[model samples]
Target: MGSVQRAMRLLETVAAHERGAPAKQLARQAGLALPTTYHLLRTLVHEGYLRRDSGLFHLGDAAERLSRRVARQRRRSAVTETLAHWHDVIGAPLYCARYRDGEIEVVGVADSQENPAVGEWADFRATGHAHAIGQCLLSQLDEEARRDHLARHPVQSLTPYTVEDEGAFLRRLAAARHGEPVLERQEYALGTVCAAIPIRIGTIVATVAVSLPVHQADQLLPTAHRLQAEIGRAPGVLALSFSI
Candidate 1:
């Protein structure tokens, strides 16, 4: 364990130098003996953790891959925490979703026993035509992308309020104004209404949505507007590409 710690220390020292550093400088900085540093550097090069070029050591591909994995994990954790915070602030079930590689994915959801989330009785990906979250994400996509998605998942009446057919759904999507929340009334689930606002960050298509019971439908628009404003202030919540 002590040897591993020494090796990690050396690696960190090497990383501090953008142009790389020589063995003697690395040893002095890491407080390791000259001989110990040489031995550990040789082992690191062999294990693909470091690469030596012109007598200077630099981080290798393995170290870079590890860094990327840790960064992604941190971003995913932040997204989850943000969703839970928003759920408490909005007093409704909160959902965060995105369009990745032509598929709708619900990345994070926050709910509790009191204000429980809607049950996923049916698959969300295939039922994109019948929900505010899906419609909002689709609205952000270009014409070809939207048509391609509908081609794979044909429009169907999941409830009395769902769009009737592909043509009507296409028209509805076209008529939707940009930068406005997509609203649905018990279209995806019985006795539930939802509103979704796009979280437009570059090319990544994402949405932040909230759902309330049909009886409390009047709160949908105001709640959605609040969510939009909150999301705008903390754009980091969706600034990452956890999916694509």
Candidate 2:
């Protein structure tokens, strides 16, 4: 077998043992000669992919990092596919974002030339009160979490229609009925209107949104409700929140 295959066999053998395996036991399990196994084990340990302790070997920190990196890539691919599918079905640019660690993050977006995405004239993260996506996410957070986020990215007017007062914004969020989509008009960007719906997966808060020119204002609420219904029917595909 090639060096990589041989190394993988050793790693698989080590992984099969819950308490770790001695060099001789690993060599037997991997079907490699004792000297070759020792050399491979030394290399693995030196490279930090395997840890040697007392006479046994175990998977190391490097292996954990590799696994996490692979998982993150897989999650990104899945999220991209989901967003693109919805964008095609809705005939508007679709956006997905999450509230993580006291901040808003726009994770994925899918748009086409016929239906271009909204321009980010202002930092979306800092203007949560001025856009549908951010407002939807903020509405899902608890009082303390909401307060914490607003403290850092306090309510500010990005356009003439933006909500610039913190108390008025908080009261508006409070009065919003559950599961209702949040709508904005020239709030974040002039001549653009948007709508967002909450995508709650357990305790995690996320949002799915769409933006269009002011001329399409009449279609905003209808599209938002349709998107909400689509999400309700197949929440598994709409939710991009993943375990890190």
Candidate 3:
């Protein structure tokens, strides 16, 4: 086996011991020579992936951090796969976003060259009031959080159809019911219409959105409703992916 693979096997043996394992014990479990095991253990200790004390080796803080990062990466991959699948199913660009750390974050987008995603004419983070994705995410938050976000990113018009009045926007948000889709017509960009649905994953405020040409405006609401129904029927599959 390669040196790196052998070293990893030794580390795995040490980890399985929980409390710790002596060099000789790890070598026996990993089928490696005692000298080789000692060399790898020493190197791992120096690299912070293993900790040695009283002639025994244990998994270290760096190993735990690496495990967490791998988990996060797997979760992100699942989310992207789900969005891409929906993009193909709905035949439109799909978007996934969240309201994290008091800012709008577009986590991922699924689009092709022919059916491209919306171009960022204005900063999405600053123009939340003008986009369906932002409005749907903001609607899920409590009034205090919504106010706080608007305080930072004041509601401004990105297009003539955009809602510039904060009071009117708040009223619209109040009228929206859970599970319904939010629709916008040329609000964020001309010649495009978008729809977003509030994805309730635990206490987090997240959204899934889709966009199409203005000529296909009639398909906007029906497609959005179809998206909602699909989500409802298979909530655990797509919605749980969003939580990750």
RMSD values for the candidates in order, in angstroms, are 1.9, 2.3, 2.1
Residue-by-residue lDDT tens digits, candidate 1, 43-77: 99998889999999999988888888888888888
The runs of at least 3 residues in candidate 1 whose Cα sits more than 4 Å from the true structure, single-residue gaps closed, are 240-244
- Per-prediction TM-score, please? 0.92, 0.89, 0.91
Instruction: Return whichever of 1 and 2 wins on lDDT.
Output: 1
**Model 2, residue 190: C-alpha shift (Å):** 1.5
Report model 2's TM-score to 2 decimal places. 0.89
Q: In lDDT terms, how accurate is model 1? A: 0.91
Task: Choose the strongest candidate by lDDT.
Answer: 1
Q: Clashing residue pairs, candidate 1?
A: none
Model 2, C-alpha of 104: deviation from truth (Å): 0.3
